[model samples]
Target: MPKALETLVAAGLMSSLIFPVYAQVKAPILPGTGQSVQYDTEGKPLTASESSLYTGQDASFEATPLRYQDNGDGTITDLNTGLMWQKSHDTTKRNLTDSIAVVEAMTLGGHDDWRLPTIKELYSLADFDGELMKPKSGKESKPYIDTDYFDFEYDRRRPFAGAFWSSTVYIKGDVQNFTQHGGLQGGFGFNFADGHIKSYETGKFFDGTTIQKSDNMFVPGNYVRAVRNTTTLYDMDYVDNKDGTVTDQSTGLMWSKSDSGKRMNWVEALEYAETATLAGHSDWRLPNAKELQSLVDYEKVDFPAIDTTFFEVTPSQFESQQDSYYFWTNTTQGDFKHTAVYVTFAQAWSKKNSDATEYFDWHGAGAQRSDPKSGSPSDYELASEMASDYISIDNWVRLVRDAK
Candidate 1:
């Protein structure tokens, strides 16, 4: 048995027997991405044959389907995660400090226990079916979340202001030479407008051209939607099957014990997952964005921000590179079909616009970012001329399937 599992079993947290997996744990089950539709490389909707061409896309596999119940009284409950959330968030944004205070005083639905959700809990509501329409495309942009059960709005003047705050703060020292103007003492947020996760500054606001520190109560803050758990929240429950696969009892999903061990473009990674067979199971598929993000152990303050006991993370094969690599997800970026989402296990590297030689952790580890669906890693070197661009195009893969 893995040491992690042994430790859990020893603590009376989980049983040594895996027969009744769900009965032995109290962790939150991660909900699916709510992505039933599939798109091609050009951001165009695809039919069955086209979806087959990209065999391991998110729609190609089954997961815990997203289900929500609107409680008529300004609250929404996620049937999968058993989390009740605020149906509509306050239009007035607040910084991380104030956001927490506001939730403490909130009494929506006659519940005073509403609290700021962690990044994982906030992300459970993300739905990939929404599209980010091009500016002046004469089309309406859809939010990455379901608008039917919850209300969402974005500032027409500020495109990125659609981001909603989570309580999980970015670890300070994990960043290397991160020198954004006004600095980055910030918490993470999920931008439903563009369908990605990023860290936003809690202290300063970048008003188009210049960064200014916020003095007023709410100029530079992100939106917040409060959540309260129905059950005691526990850490992820991972059980080693001893058959080259690991089962996450929390999410009811099984994962490959090791990654592909090499980098590949999005299409290649998808096909690789479709054909992968391990531990006597052939139904493995590439995980969707939410499914894959569940594996990130944000509590770990180091490179490869994941639990390494049951799962094997591949180290960078390049000379003198000590960090791990990003892993691809089946979810495509809604704004650009040619780009897909990837979660960084290693430091999210960026080069200075003036000096390409100097690189630093710009987005921190475990950030959900996007890259071109198919491109040579060298093709992005010129694109890195902008300090805001991330550096990886090719990423590794880890397969997942619905647990039996």
Candidate 2:
């Protein structure tokens, strides 16, 4: 048994004899390496290890046993997370404020606990399937979601109908410019068409000088998919599989225990993930931004989002603020894929995140400066640059396998 398990056992809260079917332990053993496997360049799922060499495969992550339960009454329940969701997503035109009101007042499938999902919860639904939102190029990439289970529409048809609102409002004070009607502050959301997570100016008002008030809501082309049982959303844990692999029971993703060790550019990162093998499994691929962000422990803004006890925490050579070993994510910046998105697990926006007293675990503590990943990851003392262009952050790599 791993030391993480022993610690959990010592706490006297868990027992090996009693395994809860749906209860999420911190880390669970990863599945689908030996017997169940899929290959890249090949469309069909295969049985047995696809190849012996450390060749990269296509980024395919499918839920084993199909976790969706289509409850005849316009509702779907994800068995993995035990969260019930509205089956259909309506594109009815409404502002963010109205959208929230509509969902709050709604009673779907005879259940009344439906509410807007936090950015974290909303992002959980995102799956990095290229075909789901097939675009001429990534410029027109499909939505960052799985349309098979829900009535999602992320094709290239409607340019306006791209983003979906999350309950989490963007509080970072660094955004100099974006399309916010009400005010400068943006709201957190997932862009399906381009597969990026960002804060859209949720301002419903339009004024030349500035937004009149602060009602963070999407203007138009946004919809709501109500969710229930939020209390059960995060009963998850991380497990060191002891096989150079770590499994997240809550998300059902198998990740490489160690990181890529070095910082590489975006293109290099992908190539590294493709040709890597760990713990006798050759199916490892880079994790997307949504996947990377999910591991963050919101409560621990003072330290890395993850528990260093289980995950080998890589501290930065030149300390800045709360910065863990920055890892590369498959999710890219919306303007261009040249730059990719990465999670600053060691950070929290100080002005936004109200924690004080001095702990590097919480980022956002310092002023919103140019992220170190923007060209100078190792240079801790790089003077902050306020360029208009969006520079992609340089990142290390952590690979992931799909849910089996």
Find the candidate with the highest lDDT and give its number: 1
The global Cα lDDT (0 to 1) of model 2 is 0.52
On residues 26-119, what C-alpha lDDT tens digit does candidate 1 reach at each position? 4556777877767776667776575555767877666667777776678888777778889998988777777889999999878899998888
Model 1, stretches more than 4 Å misplaced? Answer: 1-29, 172-183, 204-219, 230-234, 316-324, 351-358, 377-387
Error of 1 at 212 (Å): 11
Whose TM-score is greatest here?
A: 1
1-404 per-residue lDDT for model 2 (tens digits): 89998898776544423432233323322111111233221134433255432123223333233246666677776655566778787667455677788898888877677888876776666554432323455654444455566777642356535667777654433233344443344455665554444554454322323334354433443667788875333544678888777887766777777667666765566677777767777766766555567665544434455655666655644244333355666443433322345665543322222222232322221111123223443433223221222222555577887646
Each candidate structure's TM-score, on Cα atoms with residue i matched to residue i, is: 0.82, 0.56
Residue 233, candidate 2: Cα error in Å is: 6.0
**Scored by CA lDDT, what does every candidate get?**
0.74, 0.52
